[model samples]
Target: MKLGLVIDLDTCVGCHACAVACKQWNTSGTTGPLTDYDPYGENPAGVWFNRIRSYEVDDYPNNKTVNTPMSCMHCDDAACVTVCPTGASYKREEDGIVLVDQSKCMGCNLCAWACPYGARELDEDSGVMKKCTLCVDRIYDEALPVEERQPACVMTCPTSARFFGDFDDPNSEVSTLVRERSGYAMMPEVGYNPVNKYLPPRQRPKAPTIEKKEAATGQTLIGKWMKRQKDAFNDFGKGAR
Candidate 1:
């Protein structure tokens, strides 16, 4: 069975809770320190297991707000694994989580460059490239005693926006969710065959227009001046910034 993540962009709310939770768990758990440089200072950069990025799409009157939480796609044809020269990065055939054996890592950044999505990050402290392991520690921990073990992001998400499961199973919740919600993969053109999927945003009602009403009003001196100013900026580039 191929395991993966299903992210709901519509319900994400631009919250970085998942990223924070992943960092916390990975740093304190089985994984090593998620180093930070000048964290509270001017330039801050660190190795993060996950990142939440915002984007504006569908311009004009029908604009849309999107908050995309991204991590390792754990692609079926993972480029990171294929490019690793030290046998550090490997794709688990059982679960499809691309992981790095820190012990074997030689601080080479080749895998990070090969990844199209920029999932893997280089840790300055350890001198190794790191990426999300899909919470392997929690999933296999006997102490937790969970009915179904899942990633920290999936487990800690307050809105239940993140889902973790085997995508290959036709009966699985992840599969059913993908089919029902019309979920889609990001940047299908890149063709890494990402395992993670994002549900399309809910369509909004068209905005009402009052152009005709405004046009009916007799042009005042101020309106003429405004028109001349707009023309100056648009046509003549006089007041353009």
Candidate 2:
């Protein structure tokens, strides 16, 4: 099965919930304890499997914000896997989830450099590459409830903006959304053929405008009051001068 995610850009509110959930679950998971460097210090940095980036379209009143929660794309033509000198990085044929074998990883940073999506990060403490595994360990656990087997990001999205499923199945929810919503892959020009797709924000309907009536025959109370106030201010300014 081609397992992956379909993220709805329309509903995502730029909340870091998915990223936080991914970090929390993966920290103690099969591939982690994602390391932090000087976490409480001046230059705090850490390895994270998922991250959120927001972009603004247009300007001012008409501007719209797009929040993109990104992770390893699990590409069909994964450069990270190919560039690994020690074969530490590999994509599983069974599910198409890209993972790094920490045991064989030599911290060469080649995979990180090779990835166009910037999905992989080196564990500063462990000296190994780490990335999103699509929560492989969690998804395949027979002991867990089937509903809870999805990736942590998909589980914790409060807006239900994230979806996890078999992308290869044409009838799957992810595939259906892709077909109906014109979901698209990021950086297609890079040619990684990323598995995960993003559903673009739906077009907002324009608000109905009210046609302005012609000027009233006489100045209204508020308008007349404003005129009197302006004259008073002008007279006061002249007296002061």
Top TM-score model: 1
**Residue 127 lDDT (model 1):** 91
TM-score of each: 0.85, 0.84
Clashing pairs in 1: none
lDDT of 2 by residue, 32-127 (tens): 888888879998899899989987766433557799999999999999889899999999989999999899999999999989888999998998
Candidate 1 per-residue lDDT, tens place, 1-241, comes to 7888999987888779999999988987666688887789888888898999886675444656689899999998888999899999999988788899999999889999988888999998889888988888888788885864788999888888899988999889889989999989988887789998888887768878546334334387666666676555445433458
Question: How many angstroms is residue 189 displaced in model 2 relative to the true structure, after the best TM-score fit?
Answer: 0.5
Cα lDDT for residue 222, model 2? 67
Instruction: Give candidate 2 regions above 4 Å deviation.
Output: 207-241
* Per-candidate alpha-carbon RMSD to the true structure: 4.4, 9.6
lDDT for each candidate structure = 0.84, 0.90
lDDT of 2 at 49: 93
